[model samples]
Target: MEIKYIEKVKKAFEMVHTKKPLVHHITNYVTVNDCANITLAIGASPIMADDIREVEAITSISSALVLNIGTLNERTVQAMLAAGEKANKLEIPVVFDPVGAGASELRNRTTEQILEKVQLSVLRGNMSEIRFIAGLEASTKGVDASDADINSGLAAGCSISETIAKKYGCVAAITGETDIVSDGQHTLLLENGTKLLSGITGTGCMCTSLIGSFCGATEDFLVAAAGGILCMGIAGEAAAEKVGKEGSGSLHKAIIDSVSNMNAEIFTKRAKIHEA
Candidate 1:
C-alpha cells in the first residue's frame, strides 16, 4: 500500500466520525445486532429493515446499504433485491456479504441472484465464499471457511480476490488469517488480525458492517473496504492483548470497545497493508 492509500484510509476513517452517515442493512438475523452495534461503534448509524414494503424507503434515506445472506430466507432475499436496486438508483454504495455461498443450494442460488441483480460496490466474504463466487472450487464448512481453503494461503487469496473483483466489477474482500482486498486494478493484502477473531462468531459480519459504515462516508470503495477490514483487524489485535486469559466472551466486548476508541493515529500506525 502506498502512503497516499494509507492517507485515504485515514481520511475515510475520519469522515465516518464526522459525517455520521446512516447505513441501511437487509442482513441476516444471526448477527444483526452485532452488525448494528459495530456500525454504531464505528460512528455510523445502522437501520436493519428487511421488510420488502419499506426496504426501498429505508435504502433511499441511507448513505450506504449492506446486503448479507448469512441466514437466508425467501422473503428477506426479495427485500435485499429491493434495497440493493434502490441503493444503485440513488448512487448509495452497496456492500454484499455472501455468507455461506458454497454451503448449500439456497445460499449458492441467492448469491448468484444478488450478483446478477445488484451492482455491488464491494463484495466481502470468507475465502471459501469468495472462491465459490469467483467460479473456483471451494469447500465451505457451513458459513466458515474450510480448513483446506484457509491453508491455501496468500497467493491463492490474492488470485481469487483479483478474479472476483474483475468478474463482478466490484471491490472484492476475502477475509481470513490474511485479508485480501482487490479492485481489479489495485490489490492490497492486509495482515493485521489475530486468530482469536476467527474463534468468535459474528466477527465476519461485523467486518462487513464496518465496511458498510466506511462506505457510507466515502465513494472510494477500495479505501472504504481496506479501512473497514483494517479497523477490525486492529481492533481484534487490541482485544486479544487486553483479554489475556479472560477468554472469547471478554474478547468480544473488548473488540467493540477497541473499535469505538479507534483513532486515525492508531489506524495509520498499526495498519499492516501491502500492495500485491
Candidate 2:
C-alpha cells in the first residue's frame, strides 16, 4: 500500500515537470507572487488572471484552476466565480483555498457564495477556516490559525474534514502541525513538516498552487492533494536543515530551492503518510 501511494505521488511530480501543465489562478494580490513562484518551483506553469473579463478565457485553456480568497473583494469574487464556472464546464479540477473564512462577515459570506456556486475538486484550509466553513465554533486571528485543540489530536480534525468533504463532494484537507486529508470515507494523517513553516506569509497560498499543479497532473484529487501537502512538509524540513541559524529569511529561499531540487528519492525516503 505504501509502495502504491509512493508510485502515484512520484508519477504526479514527474508529470508536472515533464508535461508542465498550465494552472490558471484567481488568487489574492498578497501572495500572488509566491503562488506563481511555487507553481514554477514545482515545475508547473502558472497564469494569474483575476480579471473578470479574461478569467473565463484563461481557465478554459488551463489544465486546472485554483481559486483563493485571501484578500477577497467584490471584483476578484466575480472573477473567481467566472473562472470556476468555466473550469467546471471544461471538467478540469479546481482547488479552493478559503483563506480567512472566519475573520470577518464579508469573508464568511463570500466563502459561502463560492462554495454554493462552484463544485470544487479539493478544498484546502486551516483548522479555523475549515471549521468556520463547516458552521462550527472557531476563532481566527486575521488569516492565521489560532491555537486549537477541539477534541484532541488529528482524529478530531479528520472527523471535521470528512464531514466537509462529504458535504461538498470533494477532497478536504486541513493543514496544521499534523495535516489531515479526507474524502468522506478514507482519511489520511500526514506528519511531515517544520515549525518554521508557520513564520512564512504565503505558505498556505503557495500550498494551494502546488496542489493545483498536482491536480493538473492527475485525476485523483486525494493522491494529488496528499502529494502536494507531503511535498511542502518534506521541503520545509529540508529547508530548515539547510538554513541552520539563518532564521525565516533564508528558510523561505531554501524552501523554494528544496522544491525545485526535489526528487523521488528524497520524497519516498522522507514522506510520513498514513491511513486513518
Candidate 3:
C-alpha cells in the first residue's frame, strides 16, 4: 500500500477526534450502549434515535448515519429507512451493518430492503452476512458468523468484496481475522486485531459506529472503512495486552480505553495493510 493512503487514514483519525462529528444511529438496542460509547471514545457524538418522528430531524444535522440491524423491530425498521433517506438527501454519509443477515428470514428481508432503499457509502459485515447480501450461499448461526474459519490464503474474500462493492456501488467491508475492504476499483487487506474480539458481544456493532465516525470526517469511504477497521483491531490488540488474562469484562473496558487514548502515531505504527 502507498504511504499516502496510510497518511489519509491518519488524517481522518485526527479529524474525527478534532471535529467530533455528530453521528446519528438507528441501531439495535442490544449493543446500543457499546455503540454510543465507542463513538464517543473515538471523539464523535452518537444519537440513538429509533422514533420515526425525530429520525429525519436528527439525520438532518448529523454528519453520518449508521443503520445496524442487530435487534430489528417494525418501528425501528421504518425509522432506519426514514433516517437513511434523509441522510442521503442531505448528502451525509451512511454506514450500514447487516448484523445477523443470513440467520433469519426477517433479517435477510430487512437487509435486502435497506440495501434497496438506502444509498449506502459503506457496508460493514462478517463474511457470511456479506455473502448472503451478495446473493451467495452462506452458513450463519444466529447473529454471529459461522464457525467455519476464513482461510487467509484464499482470494475468495477479496474477490467477493470487490464484486459486492461493484454490484452495490458502495464500499464493501468484510471483517474477520483479516479484514477486506473494497470500493470495486480498489481492494485492501488489513491484518490487525486480536482473537479476544470474538469474546465480545458488541465489538462488531461498535466497529460500525467507528466506521461512521471516520466516514463522517472524511469523503473517501474506502479510507474511512479501512481506518475504522484498523482502529478497532489495534485497540483490541492493545486491550488484550492490558487485560488478556484477566477476564472478558476487563478486556472489554480496556478496549474502550485503548480507543480513547489511541493516536495517529500508534495507528500508523501498528497498521499492517496491503492492496489486494
Evaluated with lDDT, which candidate comes out highest?
1
Q: Please, what are the lDDT tens digits per residue for candidate 3 over residues 52-123? A: 999999999999999999998888889999898899899999999999998988898889888999999999
Question: Compared with the true structure, what per-residue lDDT tens digits does model 1 show for residues 1-276?
Answer: 467778899999999999999999888888999999999999999998999999999999999999999898899989998899899899999999999899999998998999999999999999889888888889999999999888887888888888889988999999988889999989998889999998899999999999999999998999999999999999999999999479999999999999999998997789888898
Q: Which pairs clash in model 2?
A: none
In candidate 3, which residue pairs clash? none
Model 3, residue 128: displacement in angstroms?
A: 0.6
RMSD of 3: 1.2
TM-score of 2: 0.97
**What C-alpha lDDT, on a 0 to 100 scale, does residue 218 get in candidate 3?**
92
**Which 10-residue span in candidate 2 carries the lowest summed lDDT?**
147-156
Runs with alpha carbons beyond 4 Å of true place in candidate 2: 149-152
| Candidate with more favorable, higher lDDT: 1 or 2 | 1
Give each model's whole-structure lDDT.
0.92, 0.90, 0.91
True lDDT of residue 41, candidate 1: 96
The model with the greater TM-score, 1 or 3, is 1
Residue 118 displacement in candidate 2 (angstroms): 0.3
